[model samples]
Target: MANALSFTFIHVLCLLLHCSASSAQNVVFQPSFLTIHGPSMTALLYGFSSKITLNLQAIPSSNVTGSFVPPSCVPGVTQWILTSELIAKTAVQVKLRLNRSLRLCGNNETDTDCCVKPLCVLETLQLTACEGNTSQASLIIQVKIYALLGSGNMVFDNSTIIQNQVYRPLGDCPCDLTFNTCDLWCCCDKDCSTADFKLFRYRCLTGPFGGQFPDPEYQCSVQSTQNSPDWFPFLCVTSPPENNPYLGLFYQGNTMAPKPGISFGGSVSLAPALSNAYTEGSPILTIKDQYFTIPQTLNGHCVTNAPVAFLKNLDVRCVTSVQACPTEFPLQTIPEDLRAVVKNGIAVFVGNVVVDVTDQLATELNEFVTSSDIFGSSGLVCENVTLALDYNFHWKENGITGITLTRTVGSVTLKGNVSLTTRYSAMFLSGDIMSEPNSGNPGYQVGRPVIGGILNTSIGNDTVLIARSPMHLWKPVNSGICSSADVRPLLFGENSTSGCLIPVSRQNLTECSLLRNSVHSLQGALIEATLVARNGHPDALTLADWLNITYVTLNSSGVEDSNSSCADIPSHLHIYLWTLVSGFVDGIPQKDIKAVQISYSLSSWRLKCGGGDSAVCMDPAETQLLPITSSVTFIDIPLNTGPPKTRYQINFTEYDCNRNDVCWPELAFPITRFYTGESYSQALAKGLILVFFFIVASVLGNPWRQIRQIWNTI
Candidate 1:
């Protein structure tokens, strides 16, 4: 009877499986969503209706419904079960049921491995009725199922294997740039303890990389250890091996050749060919597809392939052989386009029309070379030649209207084979006014050359004119003696002291008057151009803009004594200047030259006599080394206003601690202690009481006896 009933139950299950497969649409199972682990096969199925119902006497409530429980279930350990008698049924109610251990990876083979997939098989579900407390009646049902996959990568997608891993949190300590040094007001620095942090109430939090602490992220990464969900291990990052893009049976046998990779060594791009006119930032071309290059210095060597930038002011000085002058020099040959524009009076256009200035500057090449032949009959001779090529381009709001080239060639033949210097400079000119850049828009910036001008009187114009130039100081060249050959400029906002030994010409017993006058004249020439005003605003200068020089005489009464020896001559010149700067903005201070005040003074020193006697000084004619020195001193005077504020203050104080040192300790150190609720004495008393109780308990417990017994056992 039992065997016959089993056969009948199997027959009924087969009929139900056929009916379910025929009734439903021909659904194809996605191999990527299917996985087999150990003895069972699981798949993440989709596309089933939410209202699908399965009628059963034992488990009537068991039907397809939307759920996230199955996806979160553990394979092998978590089981699904339902009872008819129990009012509260328990089972893994999920629409897409899958064994996470059984991944659909084709590479996985062994049971312990996660990369391989197991074989597929047919599964049947049996349902038995709760009859007279016995297994007399039962029913069996089988359903043909297929897995439905979505477009994007979900939990089972293979693309989720290789996720980018973040090593650390973003912007951990932005102010901590220099190692071992504690940045002012930086809270993240480990060197700054509670006591040091008390000095500054605020932290340096500015710019894109500034933050107090990193914010929380959703993905699993290094930050997950700080703050993350409980299931972080299951969602941990994975790195997969390189293989075909699409995996599974559906993508099998589709043999499409892989794409060829791009090569790193490709053809180089040539410079743009010259059109009608040149544009800004474009390479200045002489002819069509021919670039006009000048000798430029790279690593202290001259290179001829450097192209000129349009409308840019530059001056280059480099050494080169004299034989390469004809080819290396830029002014040797002029282009036809430039000549045509000059002859026809055509307005050259650089994206717009050009209007010519009234002043007609001549283009000339001045050569001051030696009369001797460059290539002598004996051998190839070289000299210390100086080649200066200047290009002045007149431009307005539209474009360049006029172009003028001036070349100055000077040569000095030395005893040996000395290289020549090739000096090239280009600037924009508008009539009599040349385009001079200012060190600062409203104030003078540091590291820029000091702007000075020689005051002059114009013929008809009432505006007081000044020949603009930078302030130069005497520096020794050739030998170790000061001369007019080499002089460097003084940088603005820089305080420097420089001196050199000058040879004085002594014919007969001359008084100190001649030496005094000579030294004063040389020092005076350096400061003659003294209008320290903004560019294009020389005439409208105030009292603060004028800088004057005061000569200090030999005597205490400020009077010169010509009858004294050469020691009475002036030897040093000191310059004093002040700049008005505004207050701090966003912790960074900005400087400007709104009001300038400058003054200079000359001083004299006694000279040492030879042989401890005045015999050498009294001689009729003798050579002496006169020391000449100059110094610059810069003083900053803060203004009432300052730059824009970058951040708000965390806590206001009584005085500015950053600038003023006379502030009280209370205001400077606002943070009294780490914890504000308790006093020092109270905390000490609590610690003492706790220690006393701990000692008393230890004595009564007699832990030493237990320690001895444990030691003996060991």
Candidate 2:
């Protein structure tokens, strides 16, 4: 009876499977909701056939409907419970394959391996329950999925310029670009037009990789397409060549004195300090004049505002006799001490750096560290490392102390306009890192440049003097200085050479504070030109990509331009000024700039034709200035010059600032307040009317009484 019932149940389940196919639409394995953290998960390298397997399992839920549960004869028929329960009832897990791996990155190597390692990035799953196999009563759906961040394709140029990193093409990184052409979201001009393109071909997120310039700007589509979801509200940050950027400890260079003084045989005195420099803490050392607290500690970052690398201070003390130590010492800044070189026996220090290579180091411990032929372990490469770091050092005695780091907290990433990796591991610091001096070991006195490294095991009592490389950081040069808020039409007059607006002179820019303030105010305005019919044309050089193109540097500040004709004046003044007027409308509660209407007046001119005193006249005083709207740029430019054209005299007029024989219409706008003395005839007429009224009153004899009697008789 049991065998027959089992066969009947199997047959019945098979029949039900055929009758009830899934009614829901084909579901995407990955959904739109996860793109926030999706970039990190989906970073895909092109040409690698990476695949991940997905397994779906159902959980029991009471709210689910549309059951496909089999009869009691089946052994395990619990999975086919519902259809409406999309997320609450079903769960999906992805198994990472081949080269694809998950990284739990953190502050140091030790923590990275243990920080937050999720078993799998959870995905919301929806499954069709109708097609449960007969024997496997508990439904288990397995599907083969491609390994990618999205359908968006990525291109890899095998040029070795960007080294020691992987490039996982992510469509959505961080939005740091403001230029339309550079805007990844814009579909119109981004040149990422998806017109009949195949499955593997994606458009450029930005213009040509190296730079963008000289032609039509990036065509950013206002609306997103089927594949390219409009990801916006991001900054236009410059893109780095490598992906999953991280920094490793390069070298702990040297410890600066607390102040500009050092210890001699037994006494401490003052010394010369570098100008425009500040002090951070120093590392522990075993110099004769120095002694340290049992556990000297300091914490700081590689770059000024970088992530902090808390250092449990190395304990360096002196057993040598006759060394009295001072309580406190001053410190020196990072860049100030990084360039010191070691020649004979004097110890010179380099800049300090702290990185969180925890996960990467932990995953490939042996692979990450190689046996060092020199002092410290080797193998980690610093091919294209870019860093900006700042840290603090704590000290007790002169020997050495603890360290603290500070910067924007995230991962220690190597990126952008200020990154340069050097082959030199490190240079010798001020004093040897050795715990005790070896009289015979010459290696302690002088050694080759040493890059920072992580030992798989802890360094014993011996101090490994890690060498510091020359850290190179770069700041973008100002091509042109533009003060947009104060931009106005050039005032061309007897004091000017060109009959247009006069640019602030180079001498005034250097000496005058007012000009500098004005220039600084108008920061990022675009320069445009009005149509003119000048037969003599200017130079035709383009300035779209100022970095790539040969630019004629103006004698003025940073605003570099292509126009050779306007070379004499400041390039910044040559650009347009966008005024920023910050105000509020009455009765409106203003929070953001959007919540209120800001009214701003620009320099305007209407030919004032001679007119009568009428309310309909277009008067300048009564005119209402325009209100701020959609444009983020808000400005209030001043109107200094009197008019576009002003008449010197009557019909015989002089054109002071008129262009192309065009004279503006004059206005009798100022209405005359007082009336001129009345004519003699008008005064006589008023006098006669007064006499006639008096004569009529005399004839009526008591006019008031006679008028009252006449009204009574009537």
Candidate 3:
């Protein structure tokens, strides 16, 4: 059994020895490529067309086999010469000549030719592969290129700090070469304070040449006593891996903290809206896709400047004193009958050009815009813009009152927060290393980039240097401008100025300045009011409004006994009846309305199922209703939030309101006392006479009368 085990072990050892010998022989055949294959083949792009060049480099290979052949020998299977050349458009090729050939290893320490001999020439580059096969070109490398305009490419940083200005050898310099390569140790005297000692310093006296060196080590117990105190200079050298002389000193790892999420840079510019004088067409700015929530001026509550971006092609409006045009009206100050116009106007900062948009364009430009698609690789973040609007105004109901700038725009801090767009294109470095977003300065980048939460056109005026950060992921977002929770009535008198519902002895109808002069018409005080319905639930069927009398709880006895003819009912109930009946003809004989039926809700907008770009539209059913109450202090049917709160329209029309109401009572049918179709009155007298004759005949024994009475009865 022992002999058998020994035989197996001997065979296994022989096999292992054979495998090792074969592996050693594979080295000479497997040559070090020293070629560009994957990552080295980088491309570059420029925003605008410009001339550019790349520095080409080469030196004799430092392989073991390279030294076996003589330097004078041409490159065959052994000796190789690193020759540089430029291929322009593949046809106009040119060779770069060196002043002197560099030595693979120089003999003297101060020999410059051995280190600085490099051939250099600038030439136009083609976006294609090179075709070269010269006698000395033994180590030809392959490179991939894609020079497109604004393509967002990348270039790696490979130049070493130590050799930035200094010349370099063919490869890594050996320790036996020169004092520059060997004297990398650090040492300092013990007298030097630890804080005062520098890790690296540049001095010409102590060092061999005029250059920098690592910190001196104090532990070396030796002294130089010429004039200064005896001091020892010990040694401290860096450990392996980290001690690499080429790149170990100045390398910053690619790492960056995640951003504070995508944010909107605040910017606003009002469109130029000076109008009301000239009767000819002019220039206006065209607005593309962008969301705008425009507020019209009522009393003084809405639509002003928010922080935003610059407008295009705007001509400043002429001053009233300068041009003598229709005086422009400022916002909040409504004229009596509210009538005005805008003439020629000019505004600077928006490129001083005349824009020819419509009157609606200037006033409603905010509402006229929405969001759009992002372009590629250039973080062209969209900014918010608000414009100051100024136009003319005049108002008249029966009398006349006026104020300019009825609905105007001015500078204002925007309300609420803005959000990021939903889609992101291939614009800007994703900052991911070894992945989709590689960290590095983009080669020849352009367009606005979102940095520190703002869109910047350039880094700085003089120093436009750009850098990228290491990638970290918090989350990806694609958001849009959200809707605000605001609704307004926009009804005429019911707006910011005045309305019905003053519980005082004087009716609200007589309160309007336009009507304050005359309280009564020939018949009575014409119930002066502009009835309004909630923008939502205009359907009319049933609603408990801050004004509309729907579902309500009345206080102070739910009834009013002003008229003895009708029964006492809920106070709001009676008002609801009156508020509604005012729109109807004088004597329609309407039934008593006590309460309104509550139906659909209005918390959010109703998205259209079949609509395309119009997916989001206003749906009257989705309303935010006011709670029903009956405090009954002469509740004004017109609740005015003022100016931008709502859009105004004519008072309620009977047909529309009645149609929207689902609970309106049916009319009664008339009843007649007599049946005209049957001639009963005509037959009544004949029947009476016949009855009398029959009675007489019965009394006087007349058979004829008795017969006639019988015939009549028949």
Clashes of 3: 81
Candidate 1 error regions (>4 Å): 1-215, 218-380, 383-386, 409-414, 417-422, 453-469, 480-483, 499-501, 534-564, 583-588, 593-622, 638-714
- With a 3 Å backbone cut-off (N, CA, C), the pairs that clash in candidate 1 are 108-115, 108-116, 109-116, 443-592, 443-593, 444-593, 453-529, 454-529
lDDT of 2 by residue, 24-132 (tens): 2222222211211221121111111112122234323222332333312222322222221111112222222222323433445564323143321333222222223
Could you arrange the candidates by lDDT from highest to lowest?
1, 2, 3
- TM-score of each prediction: 0.41, 0.15, 0.15
Off by over 4 Å in 2: 1-52, 55-384, 387-572, 576-714
Which window of 10 residues has the lowest lDDT sum in candidate 3? 421-430
Per lDDT, the best of the predicted structures is 1
Report the Cα RMSD per candidate. 32.6, 37.0, 42.8
Candidate 2 RMSD to the real structure: 37.0
> Which 10-residue window of candidate 1 scores lowest in summed lDDT?
84-93
Task: Score residue 485 of candidate 1 by CA lDDT.
Answer: 32
Supply candidate 2's per-residue lDDT for 375. Answer: 50
